[model samples]
Target: MMSQYKSVFKDETKLDINYVPYKLPHRDRELRLLTEFFSFILHAPGKMAQRIVIAGDVGSGKTVLSQRFGMNATREAEKRGINLHYVHVNCREYRGSLFLILYHAVSVFHPSFPKRGYSAEELLQILLQVLDEQDAYVILTLDEFESLIEREGTEAVYKLTRLQETRVNKPQRLSLICVMRNLKILEKLDASTRSTLQSNVIHLEKYSKRQLVDILSDRVSLAFKPLTVPEDTVSLIADIASSEGGNARFGIELLWRAGKYADADDLNVVTPECVRKAASSIYAVMRKSEAAYLSLHEKLFLLGIARFFKESERAYASLAEAEQAYAVVCEEFNVKPRSHTQLWKYLRTLSAVGFVKTEVSENIGSRGRSTIIYLPRISAHELEKELTALLEKDV
Candidate 1:
């Protein structure tokens, strides 16, 4: 069986979620605009850095472009003998508290900083003091920033934007780069903060089908050996991504998945069928962050649904059976199950997020009387593992 597998991936890590390609295709305009806007930080030290907002839809290249700007800014700062740093933090992971976000930002420079027992103000002061003492310039980027604003309110944004006013003896200069899905979150902030960010905003549009194809082609060259991923397969993945809102992340993920499918069949080249199979689970894997945020009972409920489908002969499972299965799972895991009404709410939540599909039974006799539930995009086994990992980690 080991010999039966023939892999096509040259470097699998190239397709990883954290991987940023050396060359970002179809994103030059955005990168160039950011560089021009942020030139002040590179040229002058101690000058008030610009607070720029990067707005875009999911997988629209905002994160990568901001990272590229950071890389170039670092290099340019070094050449000019400027003490500058760029720290990127995802707000979703630290959205629960403003202090946690500040701790993450400050810890980038001071690795010895304690993880707990510091107030939000204290963290900000520590960060300000360190940067002022070093005479340094820092650009702190918050990705998925809307999550932070929504969870912790705009106090964090207010303080950061008004950093110059809050400083005492030595003025501390800190810039902020906020990468969000859209400007809707800005409305939640105070009028003053909103006006400050309204000055510099870069919007990234979703990629067209052709643009996605170009972007995937670049990644394919880096991720797979030549000819391993055929042009037709790439086109198929592009079409899939385009249909799913031109999300380049989804496009590349499909490419990687298709490659794995081909390898599992001992094939040297990825095909359209492999692409389709890969897409079947894209939503599940892509929503890992959302899964991680689910409550314990909710995760168990999802796992129960997955197991029901995996064990049953049919592609779908009734809510009645799923609720019973969930009760069994809760017993095995030593968790008390929630009420049936609560479980239904969880089902609705999952369906809202595209994790599962809930529809009335279409059978002749039972039609419109009962609802059937099924995993819409991801496989049962894959979801089980994902939920298991999330549950085990919280333990």
Candidate 2:
């Protein structure tokens, strides 16, 4: 088994979602902005910490940049003898309720805090008490914070931001860096909470193709052996990522997957074709839990769409074409086909999860309207293969 295993990756974790590079490229301005905003913490230790919102699209480096600043702040505070600690939380993970969020945060300071038998208010008191005793400053970086606000309401956000103003002996101890995909979520917050965070929002723009190439080149050198990745292969992955909305994470994943493909085929160097293969199977990036939740007919519908697009060699196909192909797929597998309306519903579901792209075509149709559909990130052939394997496992 050991002899059979082969991989070009020197350290695969570099491709991980949690990996933070030592040096962040194309983000100097954002980092400088964060440093400037938080500079008061170092200049005046007891002064209230800044509350800021960081908004950006997925894979735009929001989490990593904020995290790097948090790390730097911790070190700088220690050098200045400031009683400061940085706690990072992904609100999506700790989002059972507001009580759960406070429990996790307070537990950082009070390790013995009970995991149960506490109300949200009680947990808040415990957290405040611990903060009062420690008399330390904290910068809480809440990532995917929109989920928390959406699920539990903005009560927690308002309380944390108002920590200083709410008390007579407020330690000026807490500040917030709430990371979100967009400020549009702010619409859901209480007007006061919305107004409080309105002034200090940092927006991270998506990376351009050239920036993505540079980002991937940096990771490739760090992740693979010298000469294992050719320069053109980097460009190919960058092009694919650019087409998919300039997500650097997608580009990095393509490079990692391409290398894995090369190694699996016993190739010496990653090639453009390997990148294409990687790009053709990008839906493999979907979380298994999400995939598991897909209904069997939904999966079959996707496989039909995949097979049609694979055969057509086009980025898109008509609904009529998809329906006809889907019926053929149903016949082949001895699976009963759903109505056209049901297939349309399945297409909508697939689109919601980023699996399929659907749009109204300008060309006139027999029915006077037609929707064109295609897989967004992967080729139909690859999707067919993946869906076939997935459905087989389900069986």
Candidate 3:
């Protein structure tokens, strides 16, 4: 039976389930995006690398997709003798203020951002001068860029865009590729500022089971040697990812753990059972690692929601009631309590991380409308257990 199974694939015994990434699935859409942005820079003396935003939910392949675009564009430009320089930064980590980011932005061109030590305006001026001197365009792909507006406000971003219009011998030929988590945040910008930049946008949806299945199958082709993966095993990963709201990233992650699970068991083939066991074993453990980072108060708040859910048998609770439960949880944990607004902030972060789901309720209560929140991707009981395991101290 095993020998027969081995004959099914072109070769057998090797299969990689990790997300090494490929263009096979999104080739047309991806190139369409690349060329559209490249079109502005490929011809124009100024603005060859156009400003564009690619935004999507977490784990929806935003980072991977943008990385591919940057790499592919660089290679294509090199082949065609188009001078191009590309760099990527996750704006969330570098959030200090606008000038700080601008200072760091210089390093994207060279390691000497501090060596430039120029004011924000001077830094940008020098960068524009560098682009002109090199006769090449710089494409900066900033991921999680929305965090910048939240942390440093819109003015810093607006200032960066303004550099494009600065004229030296010619128009400041700077191209910006900003990756945002939420495109709706664009409304927060002034109409003029929004119009000059954000000329194009690409929105990515969470992966569906079918798309994830294809993604995993392709990844296996590249990462592993041959046909170690069973068909049902691959399908099982699809089901887990679909239940988790179609995150291709999660699908690849689960598959990677599944392979490890099989190897640990000394199994020859990765079976459906091995993959299913991996869901609760390896995947759940990593989930705990994330849960570990939450502040104690945040954990207690989440625990309150979970306890409420477990006891009430309802997926959601009003803020007033949740607040009461949160207080009780805080008392039990012997931790300082946070205000309702603080808890709400934590909830928003948790929801963004896929542990919770939130929806706006129009006029559901006295305060116009509040967000109705629930733990969709995770269960309250499991969340409580996971949080309990991660914390060495109380709460």
Candidate 4:
């Protein structure tokens, strides 16, 4: 029975989300900027600690870009006779503990290093000493760095940024590349700390449809058998992902899922229909669970937004229009409608939970700005159906 199953994947590991490709499409400019920013390390290995922040939306390739740059930078540094090491730690994994983060970085060099009985400052000293003895420099990339700021506050950043101050006139052995979803978290830091990072920040923009297509095509060639994934299937996955802020990760995930579906059916080729099946399965599960947690009014408000999208057939609806739709929904359900202020709060809650996406846009001819709202991942028609079922069941 197992032998009868046909396989379409050449190497499914290539489609793993965590797998970083050797070549990143549409990120050469950002990679170049990263190399130039950290070039000081090559010229003078321990001149001063270099730090830069990479900020972007989710699935914008910030983590992969930093990892790729670190790999290449270390190779280049070695060719020039610099003893450099790269250590990547996700703040979320460390739970934003300064001590654990420092310990992990140190353990990369000294795996036997004691995890207990040492303060964070002590660990820093030991790490520096180890680097000095080995004549080594480190490029530490802290991914999801905002988690640290949230848990430990700005002091975590302050400590890492001021590591050089701990040892005066010593070769600065550690360079930092802080990866975050966005730079808004920087607002919490003091001006001095912010300024240190503000000067050397790289922002990655979302991928376009064409860019996503190129990216998916590259992965297909590596992960799937030749000609198993058609251009139309790739284009369809790209179109779906591009709808949700051009997230390349989502496109890759869809491609992987579609391949699994094709293999399950013993089909040789992945079709556009497979992509659609994968998307529906993903969103249906997500929407049901997420909708269950919403309050009655929140569900009604979301249903209103969905109705607005379906009726107008537009990508976005203004806050005013959405509110009107909400009122109509309330009346249909024989429920009292909330005030504008209350609905505004609902909008915030919806966006925070990923149920809806809101953007502020300037009115072309008016002085006032308007909030435009839309569904990000799921379709309006599907949302309306789900919310209607939930709301009716509640009734």
Q: How well is each residue in 187-291 modelled by candidate 2, as lDDT tens digits? A: 888898898887799999989878999999999988998888888678757766776778888888888998988898788788655665677666456555665
Query: What C-alpha lDDT values do all the predictions have?
Result: 0.81, 0.80, 0.67, 0.86
Q: What is the lDDT of residue 112 in candidate 3?
A: 50
Residue pairs in candidate 1 whose N, alpha carbon or C atoms collide under 3 angstroms: none
Most accurate candidate by lDDT = 4
lDDT of 3 by residue, 88-186 (tens): 777777774455665565666677545534566677677777767777777777788887777766676777777645464575456777788788877
**For each candidate, how many residue pairs have backbone atoms clashing (under 3 Å)?**
0, 0, 2, 0
CA displacement after TM-score superposition, residue 381 of candidate 3 (Å): 20
Candidate 1 positional error at 110, Å:
2.0
State the lDDT at 269 in candidate 2. 84
Candidate 2 matches the true fold with a TM-score of 0.71
Q: What lDDT tens digits, residue by residue, belong to model 1 across residues 70-181? A: 9888888998898889888888988546788888878787888888786898888888888877888888898898888888777878888887886655544788899999
Q: How much does each candidate deviate from the true structure in C-alpha RMSD? A: 13.0, 9.8, 13.1, 9.1
TM-score of 4: 0.73
Candidate 4 error regions (>4 Å): 1-3, 285-395
Worst 10 residues of 1 by lDDT: 277-286
